[model samples]
Each structure stands twice: as structure tokens, then as C-alpha cells.
Target: MSYPKDFLLNLYKTMVRIRNFEIMAEKLFLEGELPGFIHLYIGEEAIATGVIADLRKDDFITSTHRGHGHMIAKGANINRMMAELYGRTTGYCKGKGGSMHIADFSIGVLGANGVVGGGLPIAVGAGLGIKMKKTDQVVVAFFGDGASNTGAFHESLNFASIYKLPVIFVVENNKFASTATTKETTSIENISDRAVGYGIPGITIDGNDVITIYETAKEMIKRAREDGGPSLIEAKTYRIKGHFVGDPELYRDKKEVEEFWLNEPIRKFEKKLVEEKMLNETEKRKIWEDAQKEIEEAVTFAKESPVPNNEDALTDLFVNDSGYDY
Candidate 1:
């Protein structure tokens, strides 16, 4: 369970980057600088950061709708993410794919999906590619608790398990999927427990604790790389924000929301670091201050960057149609 000082520091930095990025994205959304719906990755930062931190640079990942944290943790540039949200030409998707679809294939980020549980199959396909090519690259698929009920989730895992594909399915069980609490929709106590049917090893960990998440993720990642087959990791965490920007969150109790913030994953993580003498309060503050500065610079870049031209509107499309192609 011992990690090198550099690895630990990078983990801390990734989590901080995700947290600050979400906060800044919210601000930009409220200001009308960004378009479309955004599902903030507020409390679920540790799961993405922990899982992807163990991955190789050439390894692949597919993300869910609430994917900013995963992208940032997976080495996505903050400026491009901000520009994507801004729908500028400098975006990862060239101003076409906004919040739900920012992708950087060069770094092995397959793409972020707007559909729930959509990334599962893509990740499985990537695993298939890896196995065929005899590469050490593994694919990590991230989704929410609600996505577990979808057919794609079950099918992809089954295929991965049957073929012994090199993929890790990470379920960020953030209590509620959108507006409905997971308890109301499903009877299972632990989502990872469902992996039994698929014949894959399943383990649940405190998604709030970065160290705990890192430990479990490292094991699963290593297992996959060694061709041991795919594993399902269900991270028990909470979502601190409403499902999307401008959501009043009438479905959740106000007190419950307040409680989650008081015991937020990032805050809890900082407490653990200080208690273990891994980091002090002053050091934590410095970390946060630096993250804030990085976020500010990203925002500035987004604002200063020019929007995509009207003539280029028809360009960058995957398909070509005669008259419609501008």
C-alpha cells in the first residue's frame, strides 16, 4: 500500500485539478459562457483520479456524461476542456462537441458520451483491440450507479469477461443517478456485488478516500495488464451537486445536500493526508491555491480564444452529405 512520494503528490494534484475545474466550469456555465447541460464531477473526483492514475499513457479510457474529472485526471489539457465548454474553435472537438463529448484520442481518451452507460461498449471494443494487437494497454470504462441497469453495462461486461478482455469497469456509485436515489431504483446493497454473474472479481471501496481508491485501482489495473481478465470496481461515493447546471434539485432533501458538503470527498481526503503526516494544512492550502491559479488561466484562455468561423461549420464532420455539407 506504499506509494512513492511523486505518485502520491501527482494523485493529490489530479484530484485538486478536478475539483477546481468543476467549480470553475460551474461559474462559466452560470455566466452563459458555456452551452448544453453539464453534469459536475464534484464529489466523485477520487474515483476517476485514482483509477486513471495507475494507467499507462497509452492505455485507453471511455467516460460518462459527467466526465470532466475523468478527462482531467487522464491528462487532458485544462485549456482545451474550457475551450470545448466555450464551444470555441480551439476545443478538443473543434467547437462541435461540448461538455459531454470532449475527447483526446492521442492520450487514449476514447471519448465522453452524452448517453448513459454508452461508454461501456466503446471501452470493451478498445479492450478487444488491445487483445488483438497484443498490447499492454488496458481500457478503463467509467459510469454511474444508474448506468448499471442499462443493457449496455451488462452486455459489455459479459463480453469482456467471456473473452478475458483487458478492461476495468469502474462504477462511481454516487448514491443517486440523476434525481433518483440508487436505493429507490435497485435492491442490491453493493453494485460491485452484481459482478458475480459476470464471473469477474468485484470489490467495493470508500470512493471518498483517495488512498483507499488508489490501492484498489492499482490492484485491478495490474490484474488486467497481466491478462488476468476484466474486473468490476464499484466506488461508493456521493454527488455534491445537482444533476446538471441550473437544476434546483427539488428531489433531494436540503439537509442531505448540506451533510454531503460537510463530509465532502476532497475535504475528507485532506483530513486524512494531514492525519497521516503526508501533508500539512499549509501544504494543502498551497496545493489548492495553485489549482485555483491553473483554473483561472484556463478560463482566461477560453475567453480569449476565438470562436469557430461560420465557413468552418460544415467541416470536421464525420460524414459528408451533398447539400448539407457547408
Candidate 2:
């Protein structure tokens, strides 16, 4: 697929932003500067950056616990995201959602779920809403290999197919579900194989290759928008870091982690861009430097932001309050 320079530049920027943001978050969390448990999206950048790149502002996406990359890719504000991580009131969820629950409705990101496979049903519901309204908008659900075992994953796919909903189920298979490698959990060699049972088209791609992800996802996204029904795309990739900040790192071998970095998606993509003449070394450095600057600024914003006030704790519980009208 022929892509404009602007698109390529944006994709690279999004990936860089996510990588840097997660890196910064890991440091801050380790330093005890940021509150709560954190799940950094250091390795799964391409899956979100490529899949969501084709979506419009009106199109929706649901995310999992490892959702920072998805939110950043979908154009969620970095300052707000950082503030959420910092547990400040200026956050996207007013410090309530934290890392696993950031949501930006303006960009059609319903929210990120802390539960495994929580996003599948939400994406299916969004697709149902779009179908009921007769709009062409589509919904994309992002989940991990671990979540693929969930009942919601299977049930939602079946429902989407039965109702002919416009939805794309993207499984970012990083090969491990937390500590256990996928080989220890399931019998199927590929998660995409499950799609055949639901009568939906399925495709698998190298998740580390951003361009491959973009090309494969764009077709399915467009088809879903045109009412072609649901599709599942499995992206095979690896995470550079442990499940979350402070993971003991006992389950994985040290050499495996080192090799994952050697074949990291961001590093590989940068190399490809230079080889293809799409970008240069100087430009790549500048891109990374700019990303660092942006992350610093976002951190400053989140740090300066205020904490939620006591009064706000119960204010947004409902659209309207009813007390039997006295």
C-alpha cells in the first residue's frame, strides 16, 4: 500500500511517543513518583499505532490493561494521561482510572479496562450502536494473548457475527500471558485460528512490523466500516519489559529479554525507515529528541496539576439526581 510521508511520520511519532512515555513512567513508578500499579506498553507499540492509524475521530476503540499505547495512538492527550498516572485531578479520568483506565470520549476511546478481555464486549456494543444508528463507523477491540482465553472474547465475536456488526478484534500476542508463555496455556498454535469457528475472516501478521500491521489492519477496518462484518487479526510480537513495573523477572530468562530488545519493534521500524529512504538518521534522532521534550512537558503538566477535591468525589455519579421529587 502506498502511504504518504505525513502518515509515515505520524506513525513513527506515535510509536516514539508511546515508547518514551512508558519508559518515563517506568522510571517514575520505580522512583515512587507515580502512584499505583503500572503496565507499560513498551513492546506492543506497533499493534496500537498501526491498527488505530486508520480510524477516524468518530470510530471507537476499546483497550486492555496494557492500554497506554492504544490511548496514545488514538490521540489521547499526553498531559492528561500522565496526570492520570500521577493521580491528579487534571487527568483524563480525574485521577480515578489511573493507568489501566484512561479514556477519551472526544476521540471515541470509550475507556481502557483493567479486566482481562473487558474491551471485547464493549467494542461489540459500540459496533452494535453504530449498526443500530446506520452509521458507517467501526469499532476496534484491542486485547492481549492472555485475554484471548476469555469467554467474553468468544461470546463477543459470535454476537458480532450474528448481528453483522462492524468490528475488528485485534489480538496482540506477545507470546506470554504475564509470566506463563502461551504455549503452556493453549492448544492452538495461533489465536487467529479461533476466528474460523465464528465464520469471520482472520489474518495473522508480524506485530513487530508496523507497516505490515498497518496494511493488514487498514483493509479489515475498511471492510468492517462497509458492513462486511467482523474480522480478527492476530499480531505476533514480544514485550521488552515485564508484565508491570516491579515484576520480579523470575519467570523469563534474562537472555530472552535481551533478544527481545534486539528485535524490538521500534528499533526495527527505525532501521527499515532509514533503509527505505523514508527517513534519515538525523531526522530519526530529532524525532526521538522531540518525543523526549514532549514527554518532559507532559510530566511537568501532570506534576503541576491539582489533586481531585473532596467535593468532586460524588458529583459525577449520575447525569441527574432523583429523590422522589419531594
Candidate 3:
């Protein structure tokens, strides 16, 4: 349980960054400043922050719709991410792909998928390539409780297991698939239990505890990089926000959300840090202040960036087909 002081501080900063970004994003989306539907990673910040902390820069991650946290943890450019939300030309996809599809291959963020469970196969493919190239890079595929029920999830796990691919299947069970609760949808008690069928090691942990998440991910990622094959981790967390910004949220009781708010990951982690004397009121305030400044700069950059040119719509749409003056 002993962690370097700097590492623990970095984790806290990362989680703060994610929380700030999601809160600002939600505000923007509600104010009609953002163009597309954004799934906020508000309560689930710890899972991404902890899981991606153990990954190398060259390691790959396939993200779900609620993926800003993953990219932030992986060190994606914040300004470009904001630009993408604003549909500006400086975005990762040049304004073509918004919240759901922002991808930066250079950083090993394959893409943020709109389709549930879409990232699983992509993770498998990346793992297969890493295997073919004889590299030690591992792939971490992120999905939700709903996606865990999809056929792609099952098939990808089976294929990755058989090939002994370096892939980590992380299921962020926020307890709801859109409007449906996990109890109403999923069959098993724990999503990780399904790994038994795929013959991969699986475990469930308290997703809100950043330390626990980081340690679990460290072991699993180390296993994959060492050619021990795929594994599954089900992180039990909650979705503090509605599925998307502006969702009516009629499905859940306000009292329940209020209760979950008291147990949100950031607050829990902050309390731990404070008790450990790693953080204090002033330090915590500074972290939040810094995140706010960074997010504000990104918003300014996004607002000032140009929109994609209409005439160049077809450009970069393909690779080397006898280009017709696109």
C-alpha cells in the first residue's frame, strides 16, 4: 500500500482534471455550446484514472462513449478535445468526429465509440497487431454494464483468450445501461464472472477507490504484457449524471442521486488523501483551481478555432484511391 508521494499526488490531480472537464462539458452541453450528445464520466472518473495510470504511453486503449476521462488519463490534448466538442477544425478529427468519435492514434487512444461494445473488437485487433509485431504493448478496452451484454463483448473476449492477446477488458458497471438498472438487464451477479466462460482471470473491485483500482489494473496489465493473455475487471461505480446532458432523468429518484453524490469518487479519494496528509484544503483548492484554468483555456481555444471548411469535406476521407481533387 506504500505509494510514492508524487504518484499519489499525480493520481489526485488526474482525477481532479477529469472531474473538472466533465462538469464544464456538462455545463456547455446544457447551454447549447457543445454540438453533440455527450455522456459525462462524472462519477466514474476514478476507474479511468486508476486503470490508465498503469499503462505505458505506447499501450492502447479503446474507449466507450463516456471516454473523456480515459483520454485525459492517457494524456490526450485537452484543447483539441474541446475543439472537437465545438466542432472546430483543430479537433482530433478536424471537427468531423465529436464526443463519441474523437481519436488520436498517436497517443494510442484508438477512438471513443458511440456503439456499445464497439471498442472490444478494436482492442482485439490492436492486440493481434501487437502480437504479430512481437511487441509487448497491451490493449485496455473500456465498456459499460450494457456493453458487457453485447455479442461483441462475448466474441471479443473468446477470441482474445484463444489468441492469448494482450488485452484488458474493463467493465465500468455504473449500474445503469441508459435508463435500465444493472439488476434489470444483466444476468449474473458480477460482470467479471462472465470471464469464467472465456477462461480469463476476472475480479470485481470498488471502483471508487483509486488505490484499489490502480493496484488491480497494475497486476492485470503486467500479466497481459508478460504474455499471460486477457483478463476482466468489473469496477462497481455509479453514474451521478443522467445518461447524457439534458436527459430528463425520470427513471431514477432524485433522492437516490442525492445519496450517491455523497459517495462520489473524487470526494472519497480526497478524503483518503487528506487523512493520509497527502492533501489539505489549500492543496485541494489549488488542484481544482488549476483544472478550472486549464479547462477555461481549452474552451477559449475551441471558441477561437475555425470550423472545418465545407469544400474540404471529402478530404482525408480515404487513403490513396486515385484522388478526385477532393
Candidate 4:
């Protein structure tokens, strides 16, 4: 399928932004500038950028631990995301949630889940809420391959199926779950195949191809918007880094990483854009430069923003509360 020039550019920019942000976050974390366990979404940028490209401001999404890319793709503020990483009060979670639980409800992000498969059930609940309210909004639940093994994933899909809720289950199968490779843990060749048990369409595609991801997800997203039932997508990709920053990663070979790096989504997309004349060397360089600048500014904002007050922690705790408190 073909794409508009601006659409392609925007997709490219999103991927660049995610990659740049991850790189900067890694640098900061290594330099002891940020706190918490950092799960970098470096190699798998296309899945989030492509899937969330056409989502509405009202379309809800549940995120996994490796969720920064998903939030960024869904229009999260770079400054706030950086601040959250920095644990500054100006963050989306007022510096309380740190890297794993940053949320921007204004943009329909439900925040990153620290628990495996946690977002799936949340997405189902949101989908049920949408159905009850009789709205056209849909929910996209992002999870890793490891989450696919959880009871939450199975139960959430069952509920969504029984009710025909507008939810999309996206499995970012990056091969490795934490430090263990899927080859050592998973039994199936395609994780999407499990959707058959729930009576929904399941498809596995190359996660590195941004165009393929965007086109496929755009259709599924549209189908959900039109009240179609949930579908499962298994995006096959390789995790470029160890599970988190500072991970010793004794399980994999460095040569394997080098080979996968050659096939990373950003470089592949950049090549396609250049070949199609939709992007040039100058444009490509500028995209990364602008994103890096934004990252730098976000770092400054996070460093300067005040820390959250100890007593005011109870506020902003509800999804829709009338100041309910203990």
C-alpha cells in the first residue's frame, strides 16, 4: 500500500523521536542522572509509531514497561516524559511513577504497567467502559511476548471476545522477555496464533517494516472503531539491548546483537524513505538533530522541575473522582 508524503514523514519523525529519547535516557541513566529500572525501546520503534499513527485523541491505549515509544507515538509531551524519567514533579505522574508508570490521560495513555500482562485487563475494562458509554472509542493494549503467557492475557481476550468490545491486543514480540530469549521459553512460532482460541483474527508481521506495521494496524484500528471485535497482532522484532539499562546480559551473543542492529526498524525505514525520495540525507540528519535537541530540553526541564510534595501524594489518584480520599 502507498502512503502520503506527510504521513511518511510524520512516521519517520516519530521513530526518530523514540530512538533519540531512548538513547538520551540510556546516557542519563548510565551517568546516574535518572532513577529506576529503564527499559529502552530502541530497536522496536516501528511497532509503536506505526500502530498509534492514526489513533484519535480519544482512543485509549494501555502500555507495557517498554512503553515510552507507545506514549510518544500517541502524542505525549517530551518534556513531561523526560521529567517523569527524572522524577521531577512536572512529570505526567508528578514524579511519583518514575519510568514504569508514566501516564498522560489527556492523550488517552493509561500509563506503563510494571506487572506483566497488567495492561491487558486494563484495556478490557476501558473497552467495556467505552461500550457502556456507547462511544466509538477503542483501546489498544500493548504487551510483550512474556505477557502472552499470563492468565491476564487469556482472560482479558476472553472477556473482550464475549462482549465484542473494541479492543486491539498488540504483542511486541521482541524475542527476549527480560533476560530469557523466547526461543528458550516460548513454544510457538507465532504468538498471534493464540487469538484463534478467542475466536479473533491473529496475524504476525515483520515488526521492522514501519510501512507494513502502519498499514496493518491502521486497518485493525479502523475495524475496531467501526465496532469490530478484538484482534491480536504479533509484531516480531529483536530486543537490541539487555532487558534494562545496566543489565549484564549473559544470555546472548554480541554478534547476534550486531546482526539484528543491521536490521533495526529505524535504519530500515530511513532507507525506504530515502529510496522513495520522501526523505534525504539532510532531512534525515535534521530529524535526529531536532529530536536530540528536544531530548536535551526535556532533560533540563526534568532537572529543574520541583519534586512532588510528600503530603499531596493522595491527589490525582482517580480516573474520574470527586476528590475521594481516605
TM-score leader:
3
TM per candidate: 0.95, 0.97, 0.98, 0.96
Query: Model 1: runs farther than 4 Å from truth?
Result: 319-326
Candidate 4 lDDT over 28-89, as tens digits, reads 99999888999999999999998998788999999999999998999999999999998888
Please tell me which predicted candidate would have the highest lDDT against the true structure.
3
Extract clashing residue pairs from model 3: none
Local distance difference test, each candidate:
0.89, 0.91, 0.94, 0.91
**How accurate locally is residue 218 in candidate 3, as Cα lDDT from 0 to 100?**
98
TM-score of 2: 0.97
Candidate 2, residues 16-120: lDDT per residue as tens digits?
Answer: 999999999999999999888899889889999999888998999999899899999999899999999999999999988899999998999989999999989
- Model 4 error, position 29 (Å): 0.4
Error of 3 at 318 (Å): 0.9
Error in Å for residue 153 of model 1 = 0.6
Candidate 3 whole-model C-alpha lDDT, 0 to 1: 0.94
Pairs with steric clashes in candidate 2: none
Model 4 ranges with Cα > 4 A deviation: 314-326
Worst 10 residues of 3 by lDDT: 317-326
Clashes of each: 0, 0, 0, 0
